[model samples]
Target chain A: MKQNIYDNPTFFNEYKKLRESGITYNDFIEQPAVKSAISCLEGKTVLDLGCGTGEFVRYCLENKASYVLGVDISKKMIEQAKIKTENGKADFICAPIEDINITDQKFDVIISSLAIHYIEDYDGLINKVRNLLNYDGVFIFSTEHPIVTARKEMDNWIKDGEGNKLYWALDDYHEEGKREQHWYIEGVIKYHRTISTLVNTLITNGFKIEEIQEPQSTSEGLNKMPKLVNEKRRPSFIVIKAQKSCVT
Target chain B: MKQNIYDNPTFFNEYKKLRESGITYNDFIEQPAVKSAISCLEGKTVLDLGCGTGEFVRYCLENKASYVLGVDISKKMIEQAKIKTENGKADFICAPIEDINITDQKFDVIISSLAIHYIEDYDGLINKVRNLLNYDGVFIFSTEHPIVTARKEMDNWIKDGEGNKLYWALDDYHEEGKREQHWYIEGVIKYHRTISTLVNTLITNGFKIEEIQEPQSTSEGLNKMPKLVNEKRRPSFIVIKAQKSCVT
Candidate 1:
């Protein structure tokens, strides 16, 4: 049977709680890099897939976007997005991004954060994204870095009682496919895609990559969040911005 | 101008010296794994490419093979191969594997060791190997690990004054291409290919892979060569055995 991490109630609730408490790791480390990669959102119709609590939709609205649409597979995530977003300012769809009907919609921008890794077929989804975007539209996203996702266990670091790290180890990096995590839930599947596979798939689908960054904490940002300093040892996530090709 | 590492007299001499020292890294760790991956070599016609010093060709001869052909680009390596072999037992060809004509030859086994990565066109070479082999013939080879070749410096580990290790770092692994190193000679170029690209290319070229090994020294073996224990930290080489298609 097909399953996703966001579908698990315990995992989703815990994830939503952390995001609501403003203690999310992606918010501190990855979001800023992803946000800066987006060139312009003003007066553009934006579509955010896997939009938890409509965060990107709201950000687009705040930046004076003309229209916004958010899609998520989780029912509660859409509920949260609907409650936080103003009426008529944004629209929410509670369906997997794969099943969503984008035939009548054309977007000026498409963005997803910490998503797409759950989806198995990259080539098909990329083709869909290419058709849904305007010729000039930019697609930007962040996902778990292949290095991090390759590990079956994310707890490779040796930590002391006070939570100080003593060492970190990397293994099985060349192997790719479904990886399972059991930290806060059981058998949560996350797809491990290599850098070559990920970037090559995008280029194959007629997108020209503009910028790619493996986000590291700036000195000031690190000073504020000292725990994030460990992220510099290895990239925690990958952010890429690609512009749609004018020709198929 | 066209070039291969075997073309440089200085580099080739050092490589020859190291291999003859009976203390080579590949001999200690990778060779055994690559050799054992083949099921049977007895009474088989064997073609060994990049067959420096005719080690594998000699191995085939020792195993009571009916015929063996060793091909290499280096004159000195071919000379060494001739010196070590008896008349009518094995023949040595002093030509690049890419330029050599194998159309007149059909072999039960094709083997290469710590080679093929130097040649840029893996797909072309793989196709050639397929054509040169009889149906059910197994092709066994090994190449430098992607992780080791990705580094620009080649020396990712820093050692203390006493030669104790202080740090081991990994970077630039996602990128693939030529990496220049100044080891025993000036401006030595080594071609880098990722695991995905290497294995995928072989598969695409119509070879059915049987077994793949990333050799690390076993504990008892490591104890015999304590320095080889470091090789266990990460695979230094990848060994693959693939059989020719039985059907046209």
Candidate 2:
């Protein structure tokens, strides 16, 4: 079976609490950047992979997307999403994003928010996403940056005696594979891939890269959360926008 | 004026010594990876940007390139390149790569080896390169990886009491601009650019990225130089191959 750490009760609870707090990297940095990358959603069909709690799905619907389908592995998260989203245009699937079988539908835009690192077969998923996209369609995603995922320990920062962060600890960057680490609980699995692999995999799978954003906290964001100043030292996430060629 | 540290007698002599040693990162890690990215050179017109000593220019000619032009800012380096290249098809220009004026000619393949980091205006250079390529022409170049260039100090590793490297010290990654640091001589200047900026600059300038390689040391390379094993911890260079689309 695929790793479903989000379905774990402890992880689910902690993740929900973090998101609800609204003082997260997601709220201040990643969410704004990802939202900015999406163009006009009017009349466009969207597929949201690993859509936790259907936040982006609801946002897409609010932005006038004709239809938005969200896929999540966590049944608890899907239940929460169904409860939160009352719009008829939004739909949720409680299945692993990798195993989602939507043969009858192709989307104008496919987006995933901070959920791709859980995927073990990156190329396979990319190929599947390619087939699921219409001509000239777009795919945008955000994932844990390779620098953050590089170290096996997942202890991102090295601190001095006074607990001041000295620098980000980067190692095993080229050793791409499963990295098991702790988040809210133990044995949370994530795959580590270098930036080159990420870019080349998209190109090899026939995606034309449009933009790449390593989101940095803005002045307003820093003012709201002073600790976010550390974002300048190392990016925690990488957001990419790629398009399928019309001829392809 | 553009930074011409390569013309400094002390710096040039030291750099020459390093390249001649055949044990440097350029030899073991970078050169091999950059060369591997270039395909058939037969009958191709080539441009070597920041072509210190014209090493890649000569390699292209040896691989049956019909013509090669090398541009460098350092007079001393260009003089050495002229002396080293005796082929009639090879030409040298002593000018900053950023200021090269070869509007009359278009190249089939343009390659640069470990020189782009010194350039302050990345977008202008990419735009110029796009205009300099023939339809469907390939542009391949290598530069100091953003991770290596991120820190202002350029003191890559953080070591323990016994002088063992604990981890790479990464900071100032989001800050993209000129960075002055010490090499053989003090105050060598290089520009730090995030991977996002590097990739987006090309895409914005109408280039389709073909491949991006963050070269790691192979078993043979490590066998030749044991210290090269550290390359796995972090990439020192990023080599990218991009093509000018035919329709564009």
Q: Write the per-residue lDDT of candidate 2 for residues A1-248, one digit (tens) a residue.
A: 99999889999999999999888899899999999999899999999999999989999988999999999999999999999998689899999999989899999999999989999999999999999999999999999999999988788788899999978888888989999997899999999999998989998899988899999886777988999999899999999999997644
Q: For model 1, which pairs clash?
A: none
Give the C-alpha miss distance for residue A231 in model 1, angstroms: 15
CA RMSD per model (angstroms): 11.1, 1.5
- The CAPRI classification for model 2 reads as high
Report the lDDT tens digits of candidate 1 across residue range B100-216. Answer: 786777999999898776787778788899889998888999988776776566775556799875444454554567878777876767777755566556666666555667677
**At residue B164, what lDDT does model 2 achieve?**
93
Specify the highest-lDDT model's number. 2
True-contact fraction in model 1 equals 0.00
What global local distance difference test value does model 2 have?
Answer: 0.91
TM (B chain), model 2: 0.97
